[model samples]
Target: MSSFSSLFTRRKNKNRGRTSEKEIYDQEGIPKHYDRKLDRNLCSIQELFKQTTDYEEIHIKVGDLKGCVCYLGTTLNKSELNMQVLEPLREAFKQPETDAHRDLDYLREAFFPAVSYEYAETLHQLVWQMLNGYAVVMIDEHSKALALNIGGTDKRSISEPSTQTIIRGPKEGFIEDINTNIGLIRKKIKSPRLVFEDFRVGSDSNTKLSIGYMKGIVNEDILSEVKLRINKINASGILDTGNVEEFITDETFTFFPLIYNSERPDSISGNILEGKIAILLDGSPFVLIVPSVFTDFFQSTEDYYQPFFMTSFIRIIRYVSFMITLTFPSLYVAITTYHHELMPTPLLINIQSQREGVPFPAVIEILMMELTFEVLREAGVRMPRAVGQTLSIVGALVIGQAAVEAGLVSNVLVVIVAFSAIASFVSPIYNFSIAARLIRFILIIMAASLGLYGILLSLIVMVIHLVSLRTFGIPYLTPVAPFKLKDQSDVFVRVPIWGDRYRPSYLMTKAPVKNKDSSRPSSPDQNTGGKKEND
Candidate 1:
């Protein structure tokens, strides 16, 4: 594979004419901010883009001067470009007496009806503008170019979120376009304090990423930390928020994702309101939320939408499932292989009966089943959608049953692995679920080696690792590790919205108390003295 830097350099230097070959780019390979002679500028740009098939350029006469419009054909909106930008300018310059050199500002002020346009003075800015689906107008003898936002709306329509689906909540999810994702958040939060700061990463791709936070609600220190880490990213290409997440994450060796990502817009909006910062990357539907804690992965948007008590109960079930997924196989291995007395009398007999005639020991049997289930899970994900469900069902039933009947593995081990797999699915974040899956294997090996003692040791190490991890300066096991009593209302069990009015104490938001009203609502009789409406 070609390095992005070399590929970009080759493209930039492909078709240059030997005229005035001064070094245009600085040490960092960014074009210098100086106005080249018009002919030289045009020639340099064309040479930079030479052999590019999708680039479209239009040369037009402007009184005594020459000018041209350039844009990428694949991304630019043709109809909007012509009707909004081209036609008006063409008509304005049609008058024979119009002087292009002097009337440039007049044309800009009087003629162009574009919704938004910006001036780019250097090749650096102009190239970035054109790459972002803007039409660049270069005029002769002019030091600057006009970049018109003449529509780049080619994107997937807003649809129900596929990844983080909820039974009752807003069905809207983020699309690939960064602007649309930001607009979704703005629609939810109509406050003027909502801020989106843009940053460009990737020297070759120049992928646009935006950090969004409520000006008053977000923690300034955390926001600054996030920006500092993002600005420190030096890469050739960033294709998705995952790329940015990896670059800015606090911990890389750990299995747990330091940054949380979600496809649902409502979830992101809720997090923003709670003083969390969101990072939106272009060309990816998933948006990342920072300062993510352990509980954030277990909590869902539906938790807020449903009754608090029921959601709380479900949240407890998720925590239980998390425990089961992580340790069920390990416990089974430890107990059956080393400490058989830990099992009850009947259960031990049943497990021993099932293991009779099994070809491998308990640990080997469990590993075989776990690895087979993992393969099935991966196949279910990668296979074509038409057969994915069928594949999962058949693999679980047919393959597992065959292995048990063949005495390759015990039926009890199969049940343990299958139950563990189901429990792993309870996590809302797929990345978090993957962490559980990974730790499950390590735990199985430890249990096999040192039995329950090894399992306990691994658990202690995991706790230490979790406590040591931080997401943008916030504790990974927050609200639980540091023991922030005020923030517990929404951590393990979410309290009623009225009962919990303050944002998380960790963020240290400017306005900590979002709701200063009474925690309890007054009954109708208490407010009205039991009087009828007619009275």
Candidate 2:
């Protein structure tokens, strides 16, 4: 048998190409030369604008000279650019000492006033500036092009995250702007140790992604691996962080998510503190956290907001809910259809009596009900919010009552299906719940084939797949399969606040403890002394 390394090396060598072909097609297929060439002689800014079709507005203004044109890529605050860029150039052209080449620096200084604006020396830098929403000013004889930083647009304000909503935690969520998202994380952490590394992934889109992590906290090897994977992602377009995540993820075929995604800044910050890397895309609200574990899906921001005991109880409930959601319906069918002796005598008799008039077998009954439920769910999601609620309530009542009356399914089966649906909803992550729903279908089929033995076989296969999976080299079943006691405080059971002094062990942090001062208040009167006295 060939080793994994040898096989991988052989594949790499087979796919290897010369410089020109490699530039066009990296390990991942992406054409490098998407942008049109910038002609040195061309003074028509409209020519440059014609190359990029993605931008909605590309305005060109001829100023300073017959050849000099100010090229604006986006529609953001065009009035300001007209005033700041074109106005100064017009004034300079009117002057007697307006030597187009000699007075260019002075004109820029007088116009921008802001110190950050700089001139692009190369064609690559010029193109990048245009892609980043900066207006480029080019002259006939000038060797350099001026890039302005006056990007101001009317965008949606930071709002509460629709997906990762929490009741007791911070209501603020990340917006589409990458800079704003980074700012939100910085506001929450307020630590200089946090590092934000920027990378441009897509060849055509040139979409900006910022990888955030704590300097000494994150495992260097894992961090490097994540960086390498991201750097190697050579796609033509990356509309969201989800695209980057899917491209860089270790497993593409698995149903379970390797990278944990969240829109809440607090959650991303928490992961960063735990030595996990977060990828924030420019146009996406959700940030992708690397080195995600299975247990991470079961956790929510509310877990930390509530008391440790309450959180622990809730965590236990979620774990139980997950199991019930996945196996309960299958187990019901397996025992009722094959292993009748496993059921109590009274229960078996009751089930048999109830199912007497049913037209379908146990497996068929389950499949029918599950399929109906899934259709209703999809309809509810796709419909308008107000109408969707009405549809769900009316549909559930109508379907349940009609099915029982028609004698297609037993009352016990109805109850079991309903319980399974409710159990699936108990999952904190909606994506995780969807995954559970898919896996439950497989489990049901397995149960139908070989009863309980098939269910056990499915479980073993699932466990093997999970154990083989890794998110940026961190095991998917981290702190559980590897059995890290320190991290177990927050997994399976939430330990007390004081007991969980360190961060998750899977991260391999240099300083695991987030708080040096773990002491509780000595007295309630310490900070509230004045209020107490006044009362």
Candidate 3:
């Protein structure tokens, strides 16, 4: 204990001088210019990457030029290094008096045939590139090094989206690689108007992220707002899009998610077509779409793929389910505790019979059941997939049966809780589903205190809160509270594709009409030309 305490004390003293001159030099970040001497550059890099066990340095000679290459073994592909850098340089040096090997520029232009390479004169540039999986080539007399992009291709293969499953839409999903994710979007749009702006967040982590939007279609002001919010993120490590979302969201205290995110590439492509901007993070599969409204969460990519009638029915069901998920437990508590007369006599008698021997009040019973279900859901998510599903099913059955048989919770409450759970699952977006789940508890508390009137009060408060919310300055309840009739075509009920001509009015898209030439096809009518081949 004494040794540990002393060690901690020493660490605190070391950090106490964190603002001192030497510490500032270390943390003030990499130098803008590289040292003219190769040995100096090598020494500084070696010290900087002292803790990196995979740091590798190799010595090589090129036509009387002495130099070294530094890179992280774990990050750079050795095969690429041998083929693109080592082999070419070795062959060039073998030519006794080759002028091409004398200069770094000639070496890169004539000798090394790498697809992409950049000159880095500054230590800051070299360090950043090296950290991002580039190999730094340091020539003896040259003031700069060739930063070859030899980043390893060690990422997960593209697979079907685990979440946001669909029946008739594209099977592809976004992976953790930002470039791959961008490529997926590109494959869908293929338009020259699509623009992706790159930004690096996290001062220490330096996580790369990109913002994609249609140049001519997206609102310029909204794009500017998105950039401003992203630039304002000053955190040291942005682990995922969730961190970025929180930093850039309009409201921090609200239960609802202001920015919508998805793992589906088609969903992102659809959002971009609608003039929304997508933010892709380097290490997260979920890409965030900005200026999301409440209606956006209820709709899915499948809605556009299927027939209008079928999609519209499913969309309406989603909205209905959302309401039930958010208010069912509260409604049950309110009706039983205070609004008993509002229920049908037969239903009331049935509920009373189930609750006959239950000792807890309606509020307690509802809370208990809700908590149990929430625990089961969370367990199913956290546990191993093989065991999770089976465990949750068996656990729910056992716990529910035991609770009901022991008269701890009524059978009617179990039915209500199950319905609420199922309804919550109906939301297309997981983040939105979480928001609904959390809001359900608040409504339950309100109902317990003030009954149906409490539920009404909570509803009014929630609606007002949602109305006040904004995503990148666009109202959350867009086309609903603001009431734009044209945008209503795909809000609650999806109209035919041809009729959804204009983009959402709130977006103020530069190009309003999605497809001006789009029109429904008509069958040929029976006429003289169609009369009969015999005539």
Candidate 4:
């Protein structure tokens, strides 16, 4: 019995590092005698891992001379590893086979053959890998650890964008996936000159941002400036591109959007062809187009899809709608209150009759009705869809009818408010509609304070603000401010496709001349049917 005990103790000592038997027995060996006391605490890999409940599939294998323990959470790509290493080893142990050739390399080749891996020794890399959804493999007596890619799928499918809808253009919209978004853009613009530059922002989040442009066509200085501004963003989190845009925008307080946001890949591709830089965020459907001039707001994707004559007429109407939305009510108020001499006698008489028996002054009545309409608009948006429609119809009918009977607001003021609301809705972009609403209130206040003089003052201030504003260093009111006649063909009225031979000068495009004069089609009458005087 003493010989058998001695042999077992020798084997145990051989398995561990050399240490004095006295120290081993006293400090490390199992306790021989105790007074009904609990076993002394011992350090182990299992105890270390048991502290965390996150890793449920961690596997530990004990062998004769060496051992291995890996968190099952790490080796995800190695389905074969789970099968070959775990299953085979379990079966081997179940049977009584002592095949002593289970080394680290042997196990690796058997399970994960030809698989590439990187060693991560530092805690920083290990934690980063784990957070990025990698599996970590540890081997006994080796400080280096293996990291395997095993990220889970959690991406949303691409769908049409809620905003920036087009009637005649492509129905596809940018998705949350960065790679898919890039592919969409690439699919539209097949040119090799199209360049996509990637940038990593958000110090903690490391969100990926991509800047796309045509290589030679895009202005180098402008691209440099854009890249510089993007790199300057020092936020902790960037959930969407708006975060980066807000951080880098020249005027944060201004109501106007300096950068144009669009979801249509074709629009972005068109902007790129025009030498503009497009910024795409990882998780946002909207891509930001820089150097957006005032004319861009008036332009729509349908303009290119339809006949130029029809597009030009629509463009003119949009411009007219913009003016009507902004100043129609204020102008009405100003003329009625202070500039009645400008109005014809018949119209003046009609307005006077409409305001008769109204207890409130014209300005007061306008203010009251405008405020009520704005409140209703907000309520319609905040309430549920079914309730929202009911509220909008009921609210408009009840308030409008009640106001007429109560004499708090004139029927004329109500008409003006309703017309202005409808006009504001004509704006193609929702964000621009918001700006229109705000500016309408400003114009109303100006008209009330100083009549026509106040209206003129507001117009001058607005024009100056617009003139001073720059979208990515390009003047907001371009071609108009710079007085470029060539680009004017597509400005107020979109010219026929044949007549649109030049690109906008503000973009500084390399090929401003779209096609040569020789490419112009000659009429058959002029070519062959002319000069029959000899007969």
Candidate 5:
């Protein structure tokens, strides 16, 4: 409860400065400022929400003042509305007050000391607050309205992150609620240097979003670029970070994701401290990290929580899996079609025998199998959880066996396609894996047309495309293509935590050195190095 209070108290401060629609200007429709008359202000607010079925206006009194509280019916917590707002007003009404003592200031200081609130100076601000579950108090002849945050405590409980799960790490994942998400981050990184700037996006949805970064560590150029892109968003609505990603991303023509997103708070916080910007949307559990690189997608937050050598090995395996998933089917097709001499005599004979009864060519066989695998994958995702896994497994087995037996596809082709599909799942970040998945079809086509030569050309083109890509002016292939010897510590191989003493050089962080204590951990016995216990 105390945590929630502090969260909101800080949130209120963050939201106070931001009333803009993308920081350009507030949404047009309502009056710019509040009118002196109470009924006039109430009427303006009411008309804006007249179409809203949940909008409610309640009449109330405080001392000699009469006013109304306007809010959405289902948004507020009833208990808090009574105790923090209504009860205070009623208690204050019991005491006598002179004209100067009965103003908004009087009500704020004496009654609502502990409450999270702010002054809504304009009718636009008032309506915006009401929509966000704030109960606004408008006194007779007072132009200023007091907006109290009586928003409900209802939100999905934090559970293990389903998308990016790990055996060892914090089990708590980010929830849909933005406050809860920020609180989770705040808990992990308790530093005043971690700053969050708020923005109200979507002219219709008015969805809130915040970009959080370590103030001193973050690059000024990168931070400016992030804010610029976010402010330039002209969308009608932004339901999730996915929508925001499309708008702010540098390039959309490529299959690769320009930004990284995660459901874990630790991942976002860790990135923030590392001089990367974390963009969190109001209703999304996944937070987007700016300036994502090719290597960043291969990384898992759990990697840091485990042994460094094991993580490095796992990352190497992921890279191998990426190559296998991307080219295994193509390689099989190329070998069988034109590069048959590359295979040993026995293996070639076996493949030739397998292909003897098959009607379709190797290319057709693999494409058909790949398409079927994709259809089954989609079904598994869209179906009920209880049956989804069963259906996918059963469907794949039945289809593969039937195809091989009926000579629709060779047995080798089935093995190749299935192995490729399994390898595709090895990537830590799902969206990053999709690049290889999408490019695989093109590679298969190349392999079919010109065999091994076409496959090599296709791979060269893919590399050039990746090297050319940029996210927020940062190279997509950081530390590898540009070749920074220092930043390579955490790329394909994660050195011990103490060895990785600097942020990624590509980010151009304000403070490059991350480790205040750069010394590697040593045994107590090693510190005493052949000396007596007293020494």
Candidate 6:
């Protein structure tokens, strides 16, 4: 901690002297709105989208209004578009009253009263609408084109989350469809204060995304920072939430995932309720939760569902496992190579016997096993589910046994490596486990070089790196580093539901109190005497 003071001070001072982008770019702008020419609009649509097989347009003449209904054929509901929209418009246009009113407003009021639509004023917007499954209603000489919400984009049914599964919790998970994901969240947290601001990211892809949060509960500063970062992104295309996450994260070089993401809608809703913001993107199941701290990754949404004691115990195990996964291999290398006196005589003898015929050093043995396990893990993930799980388990056991019999690795080292792999999986978030994996190699290298001292130094440096990082200006360590007593209830250990009444203080949330604090509840008979005396 004392070693990096001057470096920290210099970095902090450097950061303070930096100028904000807001001062440079004084104003923001939007895309160019096209002129109100029907033929030109149709020509532009044709020139831009005609190359695609899904591009579709139908010329519509309603009295004097000569316009076209354009949309992607792949996403359009042909039956509904014709029967509900086109038929009504054609019949309404044939009416005598249609001759008097040649306006889109009248056209809308008379025919589109039952449908949802958007006015596309630019070719970009029109293209976007069509791509997203809207049928644009363009007038002959009107710049504003009404886009009907008749998009029939195929979406998969919501299924159980592949990861983050709990023994007891909601089975429904988010799907690729953004609207459905939002609906799943809305189902959990039905509140007017739940506001979502939509943005179109990726200049070429124009990917639809929304940042959702409780209006008054969320910290406005962090919300603003989120918006500012997202608005600043100039990526050509974003295929997944991971892409957007990279662009908006506070730190670029950090191994830890600064943002927490999940496929479970309940988890996202739970985060939002606690004053954290959720970034939902179209065409992606994973929703990114912002203002994430280090502890956030260690936790599972399942913690809230179970009894507090059990949950607390599980959390403690996770924390312990996290430490073990990070340092056990390094410790083995450090102890066996340099500090042989530290190991028990019997255990040392057993290990020595196991390593008698092994060709590689302790560090090499650990690295070989780790790499083999990683290969198996990757292969299992890439392969089909049925084969993947079987392959990972059987392959690890078979290979470990084979290597042991072949005098390649010590039996004890195999156990350590296997246990380490298992511990890494205990983390609820996949990327969080990855951080430990990456850091383990660094620790191993250090341990091999300088034994226990190197291991300690490596750990201290890792801690410093974690503490130095921030998530939307919130310290990565949060309550742990600063030490917030109230927030601690739910950090390392979760207390009874009523006992922990406050949200995490580090968020600087507008609504800090989760609910009005109440006394711990008891059975009716147990509280009867107290109630009688009070009455």
- Winner by lDDT: 5
Q: Show model 1 residue runs off by greater than 4 Å.
A: 1-38, 99-101, 526-535
lDDT of 6 at 135: 84
C-alpha-based local distance difference test score of model 5: 0.85
**TM per candidate:** 0.91, 0.85, 0.92, 0.75, 0.93, 0.90
- Model 6 lDDT tens row, 422-505: 999899999999999999999999999999999999999999999999887777898888787778888888898888788888
Q: Sorted by TM-score, highest first, which candidate order results?
A: 5, 3, 1, 6, 2, 4
Query: Alpha carbon lDDT of residue 475, candidate 2?
Result: 73
Write down the worst ten-residue block by lDDT for model 6: 18-27
Judged by whole-model lDDT over C-alpha atoms, candidate 2 comes out at: 0.76
Query: Which 10 consecutive residues of model 3 have the lowest summed lDDT?
Result: 14-23
lDDT of 3: 0.85
Rank all candidate structures by their lDDT, best first, as comma-separated numbers: 5, 3, 6, 1, 2, 4
lDDT of 5 by residue, 1-535 (tens): 2321231111222222333532333444667768888888877777777788988877887656788877787888878888888888887777777775457887788888988898888776777677788988888878689999876657899998988867898999998999999999999999999999998778677799999999888878677767767776777789999999998888899998999999999889888888999999999999999978888889989999999989999999999999999999999989999988999999999989989998888899899999999999999989999999999999999999998889899988889999999999999899888888889999999999999999999999989999988777767898899899988899988999988889988777778999978888655676678565897
Q: Write the per-residue lDDT of candidate 3 for residues 131-196, one digit (tens) a residue.
A: 788888888878888988865758989998998887897898888889899999999999999999
lDDT of 4 by residue, 49-89 (tens): 46665543344443432233344354243564465345644
The superposed Cα distance between candidate 1 and the true structure at residue 96, in angstroms, equals 4.0
**After superposition, which runs of candidate 3 have C-alpha atoms over 4 Å from their true positions?**
1-31, 526-535
- For candidate 3, the per-residue lDDT at 159 reads 90
Q: Which of candidates 1 and 3 is the stronger one according to TM-score?
A: 3
- Residue by residue across 1-535, what tens digits does model 2's lDDT show? 1221121112232332212312422433222332222343242334455566544333333343433444444534677667766676666556665454354586577656773576766555555566566767765445676778676566779988988767898999999999899999999889898899877767666677889998878777677667667766777889997798787788899888878899899999888877788899998998998888899999987898898889889999999999999999999889988999998999899999999999999999989998998889889989999899789778977998899899998899889988999999888878889888999999999999999999999999999998888766567897888778767778887766665678776566677676677765445577776367677
Backbone Cα, N, C clashes tallied per candidate: 0, 0, 0, 1, 1, 1
User: Which pairs of residues collide in model 5?
Assistant: 63-93
